[model samples]
Target: MGIKRTVLIDEPFPDLFCGLCQGEFWEIDFIPVLVPHFVFLLLLLLEILDDPVQVRCPEDHMFCSSCIGNYLQQSRTCPHCLTDLDPSLFQPSKFVQRQIGRLRVRCPYHEAGCTWQGILSDSHPNEDR
Candidate 1:
């Protein structure tokens, strides 16, 4: 048997990728040249995303819970203004959260016979969810 070399990745990377959501979907800031026609529309759509929670850093900037969590887990500072962060400052944006919980998105495993289509509050993945 051949020995397998261990590869250590010390950089941050996305934890999951689902082909169902266009795993490499278009990001507003990094739009491709082939998608210029829908640039403005995509930008507007991104600006209108109703993420439920707002994590307020010491700089008073607004961020989604996921964003803040990712940042804090790496360092205890704000990524934008470089201000120190206190996780306790996070607050629930009730209305937006409610709206988000009401929007129905297809399951990431839709191709695998999952007919469970509904709003996702915490985005947890399980066989029955």
Candidate 2:
């Protein structure tokens, strides 16, 4: 087997390329142009996002319940913020509490030991009259 030698060619370098105005660009005479137009275009594209998005931690440092649950098994603390969020200690929000009460009703004659089952609206129809 014979070893083959390959020659690499450097692409032709521009000599007379105008930056601001067309002119010859010698090695030492060429100024690096930081085009603001491209950056402005990028900013314009970024601005096209209309809706706000919630931010979350990266995978390795995720602070969400699932991550914390997986990390500590049972102990619930945000991996990033260390905020305590125990599932066993979770309390129903006011909205949820209200909905629960709305969906349930006491006996019509609750004090008289009458135990009936119905929604609050049905149980309190007399109140509407």
Candidate 3:
């Protein structure tokens, strides 16, 4: 293998966000930190499951929620690791949550003619409120 290939593969994605950051993240800012995943849960639900669904395997790999959600419907075992799982085991990804929150998404009621486009947090209302 060429040195160039190794060098190129060593760097992380430029726009990678760790799901908890309220703003953009650079590759250098990556440091595993303890972040609460609750408040971000609602936001996770609203955001499209474009990123990997949070799985509780020994290895922390990402999976698209929709992909895993659908997969879970057919089999309780994780497709990637074949670990037995329950619906509750499939947590929403924190990184994906923050990434989605940063995205300007249409209101959930957009199809109902609500013209709203902004961060997911500001776009949706608290149903309990």
Which of the numbered candidates is closest to the native, going by highest lDDT? 3
Sliding window of 10 residues with minimal summed lDDT for model 3: 1-10
What's the lDDT for residue 22 in model 2?
Answer: 18
Question: What TM-score fits each model?
Answer: 0.38, 0.19, 0.37
| Per-residue lDDT of candidate 3, residues 30-86 (tens digit) | 234343332222121222335546678765544555556655667877565677776
* lDDT, candidate 3, at 35: 37
Q: Which model scores highest in TM-score? A: 1
| Backbone atom clashes (below 3 Å) for every candidate | 0, 0, 6
For candidate 2, lDDT tens digit of each residue in 6-102? 1101111221111112122222212343322211100111111111111132311212222223455754554335565444543223332232223
Clashing pairs in 3: 18-95, 19-94, 19-95, 52-63, 52-64, 53-63
Candidate 1: minimum summed lDDT over ten consecutive residues — where? 1-10
Off by over 4 Å in 2: 1-73, 77-92, 104-115, 120-129
What TM-score does prediction 3 earn? 0.37
Worst lDDT 10-window in candidate 2: 1-10
Rank order (by lDDT, best first): 3, 1, 2
**Residue pairs in clash, model 1:** none
